[model samples]
Target: MSIINQMLKDIDKRDKPQFGANRPKSVYLGRPLRTRRLRLILWGGVFALLAFLALSWLHERLSAPASDARPSAEQLQIQRVPVLISEPTQDAASQRADAETADASTRAEGEPEETRPRTTRGEQATVVVTDLEPTQTRAEQPVEPVEVAVSEQVQVPAQTSMPVVTPADTTVTASDDPGEMSIQRSGNGVGSADRLFQRGMDALSAGHNRNAVQRFREALLVNPDHIGSIEQLAAIQFSRGFAGEALQLLRDALERNPGASDLLLLKARIYERIDEPRAALDLLRGRQFRLPQDADLLILQGAAATELEEYTLAIASYRQLVSWRSDQGNWWLALGFSLERSGDPLNMQEAAEAYRRALQDRSLSESARNFALDRREALGY
Candidate 1:
């Protein structure tokens, strides 16, 4: 500090008194910068920038494999399908001996209970890493075992080397593969209706009418269109004096199968017994067109028409019956009986001719022949 002060005093003394305004002014000129020093600073900044970029690149490369090796927790959860994992098969005696030995060792060595592997009843699954690049860095390899312990998991039977069996009566399956599950009912269309029908028949033959009824009803439940089952059930109902119930049963069946011949005939008989002959006629009106050769339907239709004094309809039915079965004396007698009651002189003449045909039938009963003979005598033929 004293040296700088001495220099300053020497300069002050040399500037002895400048009393004149003509003293030269010290003009300011900027000092030039040192290019060498500036070059060194700029090179230092470039090296620092390059070093930063290289460090960042190395960091990203090191972290890439770690990211690829360990999947996210959410990904692992989604990939895990709950399944039962079975332990090795060990005999009971050997397992108990090993367990006792482990307990003794644990007690002697003061081993913590928690340090031993646990036996969990919870369902487990095996996770296998897949779909990775061939190259793997040692640092990226897993340091711990991949063991997932989920509290809530689906429980299933632990499978061994056994074939998987599908559920019963569940033949339906689905897949994205073509030519699989081609038809919905491809595997299960054979029902038990026939078997049930046979069971019902056995019961009926054994005089177990009530049991037979129940069996037939069960068969009908499985297959509503089971003709044999419905027929038997209807017969049982009508015979048991449940004419109304039988009628209802038959009507429900007819609703599904309007042209079912056996069901229609049974329904007509029920209607007649319940004093609904008009309903019977209406039910059987157009049925003849479809079942012209049905003998039971024709006989029932004829009887219903006669009860309602629909002699014309009755005569038509009997005429068709006689045409199909010329030797049926009852059918011939029915034709003559319907013709005589038609209240037409021309019909009376036809009645005599029909009665003559009835007498010619050897199959006619004694009473039926006598009735035909009296009708012919009264017709004055």
Candidate 2:
């Protein structure tokens, strides 16, 4: 009985937990009987650290572009249009001031007056006009009349003592080449001038005179440096028989760029159209004028001289015109007329020779050819 009790006690001792032992007593051979929980904890920590690093890398990759300073290639191509704003003139200023002051009166009377844009006679708002069927988008926004920037440039004094001399009644014309008047679009598309200018040209081509004028004016408003818009606007005004307005715009352009020979020639032609031949001649003879061997200038000179009865000057100008455009029948016709009008016996013989040259041009219109023949008969050629 004692031996049985001793064997049970030994089994109980072997099953007890070793609380303070250096190694667990539950070991089988050289290894633990159960898996180590410490190993699992270490593996979990390693996996967690790897996941954190991967997530941080992804976050950085996504946010890099937003932190960059420079604009992207796509952003640089976006068109930036200008919003047009008008300054009230002196009379408009007085009216607005009066209206603002009358707020007290309105408060006392229990009535209010609506504010409105005021335009002087013949001046229209600077805006892009569409077809006869008005666009709802455009109609919703009120068009405000703006003072042209180019005109203001003309009024500015060049020096403190010497006031800028701008011809108040100036006018200009254009060259035959359509390309000479076209403004090229910019690479970066920074300004709205190109779009507005193109719209104006399209409107002009479509026979929408009002729309063309407004678009051109708006284009100039967007970029005051757009000389093409100013010239195009002036051309529309001239075609509509508003010669004075055309002249005013041209003078403003010339004042802004005094060195532009195209503007000078245009101004001379406008003077000729207005029947002021003397003015045309004087403009070409200005001190600031470059000595241009341009065909248009020579033709203008000859025509103006002929009109003024300056036969000697007319002869010289016509001779130069013939030198450049020998095929121009009108030039030969003018030369003959100038020589005949001189009334010199030597010029009379020269007039007969000039008439013979005019009759040789195949491109000359029938009316012009008949005129040449009549002139030749009159000159006893």
lDDT of 2 by residue, 119-210 (tens): 22233223332222233343344343212211211222112232233222222223342211222334433256777898999998999988
Per-candidate RMSD, Å: 22.2, 24.4
- lDDT: worst 10-residue window of model 1: 78-87
- Model 2: lDDT of residue 44: 96
Mark the regions of model 2 whose C-alpha exceeds 4 Å error after superposition: 1-191, 286-293, 365-381
Top TM-score prediction, candidate number:
1
lDDT of 1 by residue, 89-146 (tens): 3234433444454455447346454554443444454443333222333224322222
Alpha-carbon TM-score of each model against the true structure: 0.51, 0.44
lDDT of 1 at 266: 79
Whole-model lDDT, candidate 2? 0.65
